[model samples]
Target: MDTTMITIVERLAWTSVQTALLVGLVWAVCRLVPSLGAATRCRLWWLVSLQAVAGLFWAQPLQLAVLPAPALAADTFIAGTDVAYAHAPALPTAQVVSAIHTVSSAAIGAAPWWALVLAALWISGVLAMAWRTAAEWRRTRALLAAAQPCADQTLVEALNLAAEAHGLRRAPRLWMSAQIDAPQVVGPLRPVLLLPAGARALQGDALDLALTHELQHLQRHDLQWGLLPAVAQHLFFFHPLLCLAVREYAQAREEAVDAAVVEGRSERRQDYGRLLLQLGVMPRPHLGVASAAPSTASLKRRLLSLQQRHACPKAVAVALTVAVLAIGVLPMRLVAAPPPPAPPAAPAAPRAPVPPAPPSAPAAPPALAVPPATDLPAAPPAPAAPAAPAKVQEKTTSTTTIMRSSDDDSLSMITHGELDLGKRPDRAYVLLDGNASYAHGAMDDVKQARRDLGADSQAFWFRQGTERYVVRDRTLLLQMQEAYADAARIGTEQAKLGRQQGELGRRTGEQARAVAMVAREEALRAVRHSTDINRDAAAEAARASLEASRAAKDARGNAELATLAQRQASLGAEQAALGQRQSQAHARAAREAEKIMAQALQDGRAQRL
Candidate 1:
């Protein structure tokens, strides 16, 4: 996986979390709060889907430390100052150095073989889901094709009357088809009301209730607004929380509509309840559609919500709405809490003081070389000191070979074959802040951080588990100033190029359009009156009509030529506009790069970095 895919996965994970939280919170509110009416509860539950969508597109990472950080394992610590302990025993290992290098490259990308396999598996699952949904849609369309106008005039009249009562200007296209048992409204844009062919045999009021239910769906704009979640459920078919959200909202929507159907009618309430139970039990199409509420476990909740008629207190409703909105803007995350301060070391037991032994000529100080400074020229002159081995630097005590710097001939250290001490000191890089470590041999600060130093300021440390390696040499910041200069030069050139192109195109377009206009006027003159080309028609009788016919034909041809020229001018103008936008983009890129460099240098760390 690349950086793009990593970012996408992170955003998806966060959005899924947001959906779960919204569903959990809203579910609690609906169950616990009885005063809130059906309409208010529906709105609250709708936030689950809405917030999910919003978070997916715009939520930024807001990591919070909510748990304790884990402890790190102890590793071998290499001290390169002394030669006596240089021959540390190697730990048991499973792989060669070359194989470790290969693994390191994969780690650099933060991807493994399993990541690619999982991504491919998810794509296959989505494709399979899409295929199933398409099959259902095709079957529904086939039913729609076979449907026809109902022969029962009374049922048709009832559908129309129900629509009128629901305040619809025109009822949806009504049809009867034996293909479906329950009445379903399909397609938002030219919606069709699909009723069973055996509708005349059932109670007229039952069908009437179904019609009113679907009409309320229309009046509330349920089908149109629902398209997002309806498609989203299938797209993220594996996600549990999003599925629950869609189902919960559907139940609330149905109960809200049911309340509307029963409003103030004491007798119709019992009949509406029967209609709901009847529809819930009937086996219909299993297509993942948003036209109706789900069945089975959800039916009981829907019925319960229907019986409750008390409106929510205004203050409580406002407070909960505000709370939901706050969740959208205020962010949180589950992050490891900061580690506790290490306990002070245990007090050492009292010991008798021992007299210090006389140092044998004080082991001669190691011959360490000063690293090259930033101000030095690219090709610094070699030092005048003769290249000769000194007595103090010689490896007389340790049998291991001692390595000396080729350029300076000053550094003297035992070669243990653990570090890049063969050809040169291990060259590592760090950010200008001196806190974050970068890849070995990196010349710039923009590279991603490989490790964080925190307060441990050791220039080199040993990592035990894999290969024992050291990070000893710290390289200075690279020649970014020169690179930035080159970018600025290019931006300046682009600015000049853009101005020249835009001006040329603008003038050319203007001239072409003006010429086209002149040609059109000349063509009009030729048609309205005889110009020099058609002057022969003024006196002659028979040839006059023939010349007029030629004039009209020529006029049409000239008009078309003028139109072509106008189109060409328009194209020229578009080219000019594109050139200007390109120039702006180059300038913006140059400025952004400059700002980053300036920020990094603000603390003067770049000089020492």
Candidate 2:
């Protein structure tokens, strides 16, 4: 029945309520928003993509808002000093508090309108950029130039005729960029097959076969099929596996094309294998706008397919048709969907007076803080109170009064007490409600002892199999209280150390400032000496001119000038003293600051308990 435990339960209840509401709202949006019949109808693929992206962004803010407040409250509760009832309430407070918390959670989830707007904007911007990128690739078709002949012009012509026979539209647009390294296709709507300038001139059947394979990519619009996953990969850059899937998609498209080209042709397995090996000599770019070189894994699969020589296309088509139909309709005919799995049962709440056991209960731990009653010497005799006048008033307060038990005839005692209200014999610390809300380690110890001495003690002990169970039950509560007391002591020491360290810091700072001021004054005096030296040089020059003009200067006047120069020499000594004082003061300040820092560290260690 600790306050921290109560707070934790209350908080968890609120969290569950909020999570349920948010999940329900997301489910509702997925179901209801789809039926709106809006005029701006995007593709089903587009909308599905939008929802999936939006779900990640939308859920992020709700998670941010819900998680922090509850987490902070729970942390505070765990660190608080209060230890008391975790019961329903005396009369109504618990229910009211629970209701308020539930309502507050719902209100917070609904109230963060600005956050929701930001999330929506984020999703919109991402989708918009995706659309723009796709449009940019679409624009590349306009960049196409006139086709040039391959080195084997006759073979190129023959390939063009074969392309026409295969029902391919427009000859593949030939590009000759110095940057291109291998064959590729660029546009989705108006597609092009780009053979590197190097590959286009290569002689032989391998070159012919590679060009034919790339042309097949243009004929079937493989780029269009790849666009969604490409955009998905772009948007979900964080998901490495998704990008891998997109790469696999590109490979699959190429292999599918290869399968089509060799379907019924009278060619040996070595023919295609040679073609794959020749094409893989160069690395391809993953421009996303084009299917460049097929990946190595794709090349391997194509070679293996040639080696295996699967049944021809006509036979494969009939088999695929049967398989697809069976998968599509077989489940509905064979079995109805099983009923939804039952929801998991909620955990039972920790009850009043019957606190939860600690996460890992100690193996046969001793009772906590039930100091042996005999530890104290005999109690002092109670002084007799003089009767007061009727008008004299007194304040009622609770106190524990222990007395020797007359019935026990032993050295046993009982703590029985009541609040000394003017005209009532109301028992102290017991409420009118059935709940026993006042709990403390010392109080629990007394209660356990009293129960062990009572008439029902025998049966209770028989049922639980030990008199020690009563002590064990109350031990957890005692352990918690002792822990709280220790924490309070540590906090007190830390607070005291903090105050002392602050005072020390302030004093050291003042001393440091005084030292800095002295240093500044000494620097100013040093500057004055340089100025005096300059003035003396001018004086000596003036004296030489006066002596030359008079030619009758006396020895008395010269001696007086010498005495004045001696006075200036003494001033220089005073300047040296000032410098020495500044240095000493700075050193003293630094030593004091270091001493204070060490003291602060020691105090901090002590305060940590």
Candidate 3:
């Protein structure tokens, strides 16, 4: 299988095992302590679930150890031993050489079908559970929308009283709904206390008790505890222990809420017990809501605990809470298994020591004639010649045939149908191996040849048997020296080229950075310019508005002044008309008076006459 897929499968299995172990630990702790508040226990479950889920993302193993393979003793045999022993050989030289050059390949397998199936099943379960949770939440939301504010003033007062008694900063909103069976608290931040329609008719004390129970949940923030465990339970629906732990968490949470409500209020404990018993018959709260009452068994336990006033001590509760938290976090550290043990080492066999070679016989002295004894006696009589000085000579041996190449007149060893030079000459190459000694010996032989056979020598002594050949070609030595000089030149050029390339790269990078900086500066300038333009535009708009307002005020004042002037002109025209009328009336009055006076005079005159 694909190693990646196999590793994924292994990690999934390990995480599942870790989660199971953690859940069991949680379950056992909850069962043992019973005093660790539901909130604390719920938090522990959440921690373990998170740790398990987090383990999936942990790509590295907890511990990695390289278990080396055991060393095996290599089979040893002498070369050409089969010929000596008259037996078949292990392998041909060519076959062994080819085997050394061979490379190994591996086939990759496909992912197993079962792993895919398991993954698909897990995904499907999660989806199904998620859908269920969503649908229930939707139902709860619909029910919440249908609920109406409680019309009873007494219940509202009781809710406020209970909240203030519990030291709640803000009283939760209270509503009455006919859809819900039991009183449950919903919403974490702005909590809502939902009461059944039947609760409307409940006695004042029972209503107070129920309100107090649900309010205790709100005050303690138990509604927020169910969310993580619910998600964990849904995701790991396959694990029975997780399901049990979730159920236990819910029960413990309700108990904790119950204890908080009736802790100090001894007188109301009976009423609270009765309220729980009454609500216990109702359907359980929706998964999205935190009910004031749990199952019948849990209700009985709550009632008994309330009656007995059984409560966890603060110190004990704190200690257990810390311990449980440690348990939850421990799995994350210990999830990885230890690496396998290394294999034992194999013992090596002892090798046989090789025998040393025997010493060579002394060389025979050159023969001299007997007549030479008579002649030599006279020659010896001339004078015992001074003994010659000994010369140091280097010994050489050959393991293959030595051939002289006509093209280059260079000596080469013939081995296994191939000519092998003592060493391949490379430019500026220093011989650091036995080849250096061979070259030094050859140079010494050439020096001796030049000293003994004149400085214009063209060839050196060539031994035809198991002895070394001395190279004496002046052209070859000169060519070798030239090659070394060329190699040194090439090395220097390469170094110079590398330096140039590095410099060029540095310059290019600097130029790129400079261009980027310039672009940034240009962008900043554009942005500043745009900001300035916008600011000027806003300022101009404000100025125009100010000018327009001033002009409008001026226009209003001019209109008011013109209206006053027109009113004054109308008043003046009315006055002038009034004066003319008055004058006409006075003239008419005078005319009438004159006529009356004339009449009066005429009458008087006629009477007198």
Candidate 4:
């Protein structure tokens, strides 16, 4: 397998193991401390999840220190030298003696096929989980859009009262939708309480009970808690234990929130429980929304928990929180020490000295009489060569001994030197004294030991004008020291870089949160502005409708008045015609009477005639 793949696999394996251990540990603690509140237990689970994430990025090398061998002589010395060595012993490996050598060799390479397959599998799982979560979230958002504000004034008042009773500064916006079957709370910043259309039929107290439960969810930030586990699950979808832990965490959160909602109103526990049961009969909403009512199984558990009169103690919760934090932080503390330096290689064996050749007949005595007469003061007879410095003869003796200890066998070399000053007292010195040990089982016998020691086994001395001095060689020791110093410097630099990275990460997180807060505020402002615009538009439409109704009524009244006037004119005309006719008839009747009277008169005249 290639190094990169191997390294990745190693890291993944370690991370998985650490995650499993942390989850198991937290789970055990929760089980043992049943009195710990659900909120606290849920937080513990969060800690475990975070610890698993941290383990993925944590890297530390395990190192072993190379210890110096004990000294057999008072001082240390090099072989065949009179100088005493003052420094401590060093590793005898040549490879590690170089200051530039790394503590560990490269062990990772190109990834193997199996590793690639595993990585692909993990990625696929994560993507699948993420896709599922996104789909659910989208569905939930669509459901939210279909919801409308509750129009019932009594229900609105009850919601406000419930919010006040729950000590919430701002009550979540209440919306009712026929699309949903259960009550749920959505949104983190501008929380919305969604209810089914059936909620309109609930009596005031029962409705309040439902509102209070959802409001408690908002007040306690249960949605946010639920999201943390969801994220963990998305990342570790393949890990069944993680999924289980998330499930348990969700249940605990619900139970905790339930307790909080019914804390003071102990007498109404039954009512709240009944409400939950009633809501449970309806279809549960999408997991993306935090439902006030849970599934049937969860509802049963919650109802039973409601029957309990007492809550988890504060002290127990606090203790469990601390313990959980410690457990999460414990895995990070297992850093390894730096590795020890390798031992230096043994020195090569010394060569034997060559003997001096004969003078070869003195080169035939080249013509001595030649320039004898030059007489330029005859070069002032070469000043008698200064008397040769008195020669001091030095003698040195060395002794070797082997010591056996319970754990190892050691070889010791001791050397002593004497300086002989002609016509003066001689000086004696102790040189080259130290011991080297090999683990008892490291080698077979003394023969292997001798082979390992090689030229290092001999003690030698040097002479100058009959003066002798011995020196111990510490080249390997110096190199080991340099290597150790370099390692220390690199470690210090790494620590500084780590601190800088941590600071940068923290600052980045703070900036992101600030930006998010600003964005959230802007979005809320936009929503409020839009809502006001809609409200104003609706009011204007209603006024316009009223004005149009009044105008239509006036037009009808005008038509009625005109009809009455026309009828009066027709009656007046008819009366005038009738009067005219009666006058004509009277005239005719008078004429007739006149005619008759005239006739009668004529007749009377005729009769007179």
Indicate which candidate wins on TM-score: 4
Using Cα atoms with residue i matched to residue i, what is each candidate's TM-score against the true structure? 0.48, 0.32, 0.47, 0.49
In the predicted model 2, the residue pairs found to clash are none
The global C-alpha lDDT for each of the candidates, from Candidate 1 onward, is 0.51, 0.39, 0.49, 0.50
Between candidates 1 and 3, the lDDT winner? 1
lDDT of 2: 0.39
- What TM-score quantifies how close candidate 4 is to the native fold? 0.49
Which 10-residue window in model 3 sums to the lowest lDDT?
374-383
Arrange candidates by lDDT, descending.
1, 4, 3, 2
Candidate 4 lDDT, tens digit per residue, 117-182? 877777788799888867877987898788888898877887787788777887778888887666
Q: How far off is residue 307 in model 3, in Å?
A: 3.6
C-alpha lDDT of residue 412 in model 2: 48
Residue 516 local lDDT, model 4: 42
Better of 1 and 2 by lDDT: 1
List clashing residue pairs in candidate 1: 67-337
List, residue by residue over 322-413, the lDDT tens digit for candidate 2: 43333221111112234343332222222222111112222443766332221111111211111121332354332222212323445343
Between prediction 3 and prediction 4, the one with superior lDDT is 4
**Residue 571 CA error for candidate 3 (Å)?**
99
Sort every candidate by TM-score, greatest first: 4, 1, 3, 2
Misplaced by over 4 Å in model 2 are 1-160, 198-200, 266-268, 281-295, 311-609
**CA error at residue 87 for candidate 4, angstroms:** 25
As a TM-score, model 2 comes out at 0.32
